[model samples]
Target: MDIVNALALFANFVAVPATAYGAQLALGALGVTLIFGILRFANFSHGELMSFGAMATILVTWTLQDLGIGIAPFPTALLALPVGILASIAVSLATNRMVFRFYQRRRANPIVFAIVSVGVMFVMAGLIRIIIGPDDQSFADGERFLITAFEFQKATGLKEGIAIKQTQVITVVVALVVVAALFWFLRKTRAGKAMRAFSDEEDLALLSGVNPDRVVQIAWIITATLACIAGTLYGLDKTYKPFIFLQILLPIFAATIVGGIGQPVGAILGGFVIAYSEVMVTYAFKKVITYLSPTDWAPEGLVQLLSTDYKFAVSFIILVAVLLIRPTGIIRGKVI
Candidate 1:
């Protein structure tokens, strides 16, 4: 129970992995929130969209690797991100035109739209599994760890070494840039303002000469881009599998719900909150606590709060709690 040691251990647990995971969840939640705001429905298919984008990036990266082209200090998948984004955009737009567009034309209820999205999710899930054969694929190569623990220890001459992966650093930086750009666009740009207008009041926006179809198209494109970025980063940091995307759905939804389904800022905050909670709750703090704690005060039992297998359950519990406490979300997201 040495306070200094306990604080340091907590910091380590909270800082690195939480940051990387928060960025990933934020990116995924951004897409979900945008769809909820603009399209006015919960997109259950978003996780599958992420999987599709990650798979596309993996394919492109492999192709580039075969050609002997790569980013030396970074993963080749980083270089192939744009291709993956474009492919995801195409898929999202095509889905809108073929499946959701019919429902839109008929002015379907929000509940019906939600149901349709679930159907779309199943279809996309099946498509990804068919293409990838439901196998795990590692898409990371090149620089593995950005700063090795030993290197940091050598440089700082501190007993505590901090290891940062190149992919992890990239994930944080890229997510920041993307989120900043999105906020700037939403707040300042003409097209971005138009999108906000549509989300705020579709009828009024239409009367204001905003093109509905164009706004919807742009929303889908932006969502696709965010999905591509998030999915690729997640794949790089962890491993890519069609099934993992489905598993990520709970965290993404948790973020969106906890933040307020249609609120952008809420989504970002919710992502980090969920990520840190899940990581902290499940992480075995034995090594970290031992490093900092005095021998006499250290607990006999492992300091983990929950098993890693229950990560999804943690997210679901948070989602439900948020729903009961503030159904509109912390940001007062529109219920409609």
Candidate 2:
């Protein structure tokens, strides 16, 4: 049994997947947080928006592949990102104008808005399934690995090797860039300040000359952009399936709640926390144990807290815990 081997295996199982998954969750959580801040409600439709974005990117990637305009160092989906984001923004704006706008005009309660979002979710889900045929599709292409395990082993002359996938690297880079840009926009720009002011006090913001309708419109567009980027990156790293995005709702909700709804920084942290917890708890640790333990001391059973099938349950448990202990969330987000 070697401690070095055990650490290596643990790093592979817990660290790598956690970082990758954390990025995806962070992206999703950002969208949820933005909507909560500006729209003043929990948008249940966000999961489907992400699905729609991913589906759009997948379709575009397929088209590009057919046209033989493939990316070499990155996935073709990366090239299709701007188009997918634009399409998502357009769809979101249209939905707001046609559906949610009515409710806003009526000055509907937050609960009513939540219910409306649910209806929108269903519609978007159906549309995605119809367009994508309810099947799983891989959108990843070009360089698969940034650093292959064999290459690492040969270079370092170590028994253990590290393999970093190109998609994983790209996902992290893109998320960082997007997040930085978002923060800059929110903190530095006049529209961003107006958005914050609106979130702080809608009536006051209106009195201060901020156009309520315009703020709502901008929020929807920004939320849609975030969803598109998050969804596309997740699809590139994993496979694109309309149903999987639906399943992502729980974790995204958990992250939003844990971080304190409407707090962007908290959302990011919550995303990473939830992602690591899920991956670490569900991941089988047999390989890690075998690498570390002596033959006689190794356990017979797999060292996993729960099966992957119960991942959603894990998120729900966390959500319940947070609600019971601190309903306002870690950052004390707006109760509304």
Candidate 3:
């Protein structure tokens, strides 16, 4: 029973939430990695891009709810997700046309592009706050949980049982599907092949008649699509707040770098690693330990390695460590 309770506590505090968070981070990091591999610049504006998408989804979902539309057991935001994706695509295209294209034409240095993206980041970040405000918005609707804690314990007739949220399951499932589709698109499509060729050898790709503009357009579209999906999932799992997306930028970047800056597999791998570390390090294991310990033998301390207030600090520490210790990332130099 003690062992079971200990396992349940671990599942409740660390496994479930971290997995959902990791899935969200992985999707965001994938977009970042894709941009790094293909477009060759750190897209500092992606956080705002994500915020914009979530805002779009939330607004549309509200409108739909007001109109008496809902999916009952699942969130209506799922249905409204495409609207957010479309809005994000529009923003991405407009940004690329009005901003990034000039730099691309000039063949500017990557750092120059990075600086420009920083400026765009501020503008977009401000625009999202103006549209959505800086307050937390609850956009979730329908059934909130696949199983409640008490229900799970009752059903299992156990001292401890793990509860799983509907959003968490949905997030993981959606992320898996999206990743699979993306991998398929990249591996088996002509356009994806062209993009890969461009990323691999730009001069040769141009010589091979791959249109640069087409590639750029596709990259922006995919990045925006990814941003929307990730943002919407995150908002549904947590809550929608403009500023939170800005903070999320740190973990997404940390994941991308830890997985390997230009590697998709690395990005996904890095997200889970960072998420688990954050959760495990910050979580208090006192109750679980008490359950597992003999009578009056439990430790007195909280059994937490770090306070939850410093969760994001874990990502920062990991990011700095990775930069100093393994600049090539955990996966070595796999570019894409």
Candidate 4:
């Protein structure tokens, strides 16, 4: 009974939150990886793209709320997600048209494109901040917790209880749906085949009659949808802040690199690994130990491996290690 309770405590504090966070990170990383694989350059502006979509969603959600519209059990943000995605797609397309196309026409190097993306990142980030300000934007309506601690305790008749947030559940469900749809599209659709063929060999694909422009356009659209969904879900889980989105770029990049930068499945795996590592290391195990051990045997220390403030550093360290150990990544993605 004590062991079970201890595990329950761990699940309540660490597992559930980490899973939701990992799913969100994976979705965000997928956008980054897709762009890198298909577009042949790292778009540093991805974080800003997320911010743009999330800000758009927030604006629309506010408008809907003002009109007394809501989804009740689910967040009204769900309904506004499509609007956010479309806004992101427009921004992506416009940038590709005005800026990326110039580089494409010039046949610039990948590093050049990367440097250009950094400039675009700054411009886009500034625009978002100017438009939305650098404050927390909170607009969520519906159930708060799908399973409360007290309810879990009552149901299980255990000393320790688990609490799962509604947002967390929604995040997992939505991520699974999105991932499934992406896999189906990529595996079964004609355009997806063209994109894959292009990624495999540009010259061969070109000779085989694949349209580079169409492939790039489709990639941007998919990347935009993924970014927008990830951004909105993250904001719903936490809060919408322009600066926070920028910070998220670190973990997202880490996830992408660790999981094999160009591999979709690797991104998902890396996300969970990084998330669980962060949560487990930072979470103080004192309570769980106390529940498990005899009263007198309980430890005095918090038993946390690291402070929560150092959580982001975990991703950096892991990323460096992966780069050093296997440049090709765990699942054999693009070698960096």
Clashing pairs in 2: none
Scored by TM-score, the top model is: 4
- Lowest lDDT 10-residue stretch of candidate 3: 327-336
User: In model 4, where do residues sit more than 4 Å from their true spots?
Assistant: 294-296
Error of 4 at 304 (Å): 0.9
Cα error, candidate 1, residue 59 (Å):
0.6
Q: List model 4 lDDT by residue over 55-86, tens digit each.
A: 99999999998998988988999989999999
Global lDDT of model 4: 0.90
**Cα deviation of 289, candidate 1, in Å:** 4.8
Roughly what TM-score does model 2 have, to 2 decimal places? 0.95
Cα lDDT of model 3 by residue, 13-58, tens digit: 8899999999999999999888888779888999889888888988
TM-score of 4: 0.97
The C-alpha RMSD of each candidate to the native structure, in angstroms, is 1.9, 1.7, 1.6, 1.3
Q: What would the TM-score be for candidate 3 when compared with the true structure?
A: 0.96
lDDT tens string, model 2, 93-202?
99999999999878788899999999999999999988888888887889999888889778877677778889888888998999999999889999999999998888
C-alpha-based local distance difference test score of model 2: 0.88
For each candidate in the order shown, give its overall lDDT on alpha carbons.
Answer: 0.89, 0.88, 0.90, 0.90
RMSD of 4: 1.3
